[model samples]
Target: MTSEKRESALGALQSNLKKGHVYRREDLLISSNAVDRHLKQLLKSGVLEKLSQGLYYAPKTSIFGRLPPKEDDLVRAFLKDEEFLILSPNTYNSLGLGTTQLHNKTSVYNHKRHGVFKMGNRSFEFRIKPRFPKKLDKEFLLVDLLNNLNSLPENKDVILANIKKMLTNFDLIKLEKYVLLYGVVRTKKTVLSLLHDLR
Candidate 1:
């Protein structure tokens, strides 16, 4: 690959960036045939490391040798679909959820079902759930926030504070709507109980 082509590819990669470690060929360019060939050459030269077929990451050299590619590189490559959002293991762990319990390699909850794809060595999983009404953003946010808070480190005070913050910022009507939508009566009671305790 010529320096100019290589530079252009790198520039593209740096721009249009997303969270996590992986990227897709389509993401790199509108047309990736030439870009893929050049990227492969870069891989052969040790300029980059191929995580899996069609997935690559810039490798960092250590005094001992080359370090392994970051896990996010593989994740970014696997999670190319715009419809599904990728959640890191930390995020999952924070949510107090376990990958083993999920029984899928790559699991994401969405409103619509989609087929899985393999990128590099990892497998991606998608989950389709019922969709909510358009006016329930606050409610959905609170539900999501509660779910994630459960996964966070155990700190009662912190959790209470966050819940209060969420309640303060959220619309009460939306909260009621979300409670009805998710059937989270116990969660609503818990929030109310916590607020009472705070008082």
Candidate 2:
């Protein structure tokens, strides 16, 4: 029977997810229709939650009843596809770096704007910016640091110290390469000088 099969499938999924890991829809299904129906049933029953349209997770329950991971983590988990990355306004706030005046909306960037996705109480606004630096190399890293700096408290010493620490781990050559490629002149100058002093 369809009901029996669905129950069996849900059980299998629940068992696998008991390890506290997240799984993508495709990874859990041999047939798409089966996944679709089963996911709908589970979501309705509150046995599973829709993190994103195609992404779902088993909620963690506590004395508070159900406790979800922070918004950023939920977004990141839902965005397991490498083509997209989650960029929440509270990314810095979630990481204890800053306070976010906007909590209801989060932004994400990849290569294309994928529209918006709403999951439970939150809504995510997705957009595509130019690709991030190839890896976490210095130049791109500085851009990331600067981009997230508004999250930090307004303390000059703390800001400079954080900058110095971030610079210490940078690759000057790669930084310069991206600086030239991206025309990030201000960051280029600041990082180059810092690298010179650190050397």
Candidate 3:
């Protein structure tokens, strides 16, 4: 490609990279040669930040420093789809339960990509669950918290008891529905037992 064509392609590509948005090479739909040249130029000029292979983002700058794109945006670029949920065990701590331990890993419940993946400066634990919430909800979080209880480094009985107490404060109907639909068999059993105790 001529210098004019390369510059034109780069301009077009840059036009599409909205700030705080993550992108993939294929999303540009430009010829491979031109796309690569343009991307290299953009990267060299600090206009675009490459997160990984074929994935890039237009950083959001702040007074502190350059802010990375949202986790969901990065995951979308990694998975190439919006059908995934990113969560962390630390979310469980927000329930006011007695558990106070901090967790460093973030979990990605996605259909594709099963295993841990290092994206940028963070690590994501990808799990392929048959069913996962399209969006995060308290009810779903309660259910998921129960579902992964066994894997947590805490006292199971104590957590269950705490969850039992916590259940009384949530919407019973929604919690029940989430347990039956999104929760595993063990979680269902625990939730059912807790509900039965309330009745």
Candidate 4:
């Protein structure tokens, strides 16, 4: 009788969740008594993939087999909120500032959860910041690059020189605004000195 109920509950759950969509354990609306058993059954059957504790997703299979869940989906489920920004030091490589080293970690800027979080076999360094841009932009990236300069494994003076040269091509007004809004004390000071040189 309990097995029958679990089977019925699993069927209802499978029908409700669309493929490739991540669902938190709390997202289930069924009675809580057998929810754990139902999830275990589903996992054993390969109908769902357990991403982490309390997080599951209906597998999206392809010719290559099952695909991993999207990073945004994992983050949304983990944070239980959509307000966050994802970035990586690798972004700095595109700026042509001579930063050739590759980094494995990603940074998640948000108001909540300040610590490292593991998502789908990847590490995300969550930083609690007072302010962050809704979307990444070149000017903002420049400011962030300087903000994390000391952390990067690179020659700082060379990178700073390259950035100083590049700033002349950027919109001074917008760059200044980004500096004020998101730049750390060290970053702001450096940008201000560069802007003064530009004048």
Which stretches of candidate 4 lie above 4 Å from their native place?
Answer: 1-5, 30-33
How many clashes would you count in candidate 4? 0
lDDT of 3 by residue, 1-199 (tens): 6788777777877876788888888876653456777788889988888887888888889999999889988998899878899899989888876667899999999889898888778889999888887888888988988888878898888887778777778889989988989988888888888899889
Name the better of 3 and 4 by lDDT.
4
lDDT computed for candidate 4: 0.85
How well is each residue in 35-112 modelled by candidate 1, as lDDT tens digits? Answer: 666566656765655555667666556788756555444543455433444443333333332222332354455555
Candidate 2 residues 1-199, lDDT tens each? 5778767876776566643344468766853346777777777987777766677777888777777656555655666555655554444433232243445556666665577877666777776667664333335545554554555455635655666775545566776666555544565576567777976
Candidate 4 per-residue lDDT, tens place, 83-144, comes to 88889999888878878889998999988899887656778899988889888878888899
RMSD of each: 8.8, 5.9, 1.9, 1.8
Model 2 residue runs over 4 Å out of place are 2-6, 19-24, 31-33, 69-80, 83-107, 112-116, 123-125, 133-141, 144-178, 181-199
Query: How many angstroms is residue 117 displaced in model 2 relative to the true structure, after the best TM-score fit?
Result: 3.9
Residue pairs with backbone atoms closer than 3 Å in model 3 (clashes): none
| Highest TM-score against the true fold, candidate | 4
Better of 2 and 3 by lDDT: 3
The alpha-carbon deviation from the true structure for residue 148 of candidate 3, after best TM-score superposition, in angstroms, is 1.1
lDDT of 3: 0.84
> Per lDDT, what order, best first?
4, 3, 2, 1
Ranking by TM-score: 4, 3, 2, 1
Worst 10 residues of 1 by lDDT: 95-104
Per-candidate clash tally: 11, 0, 0, 0
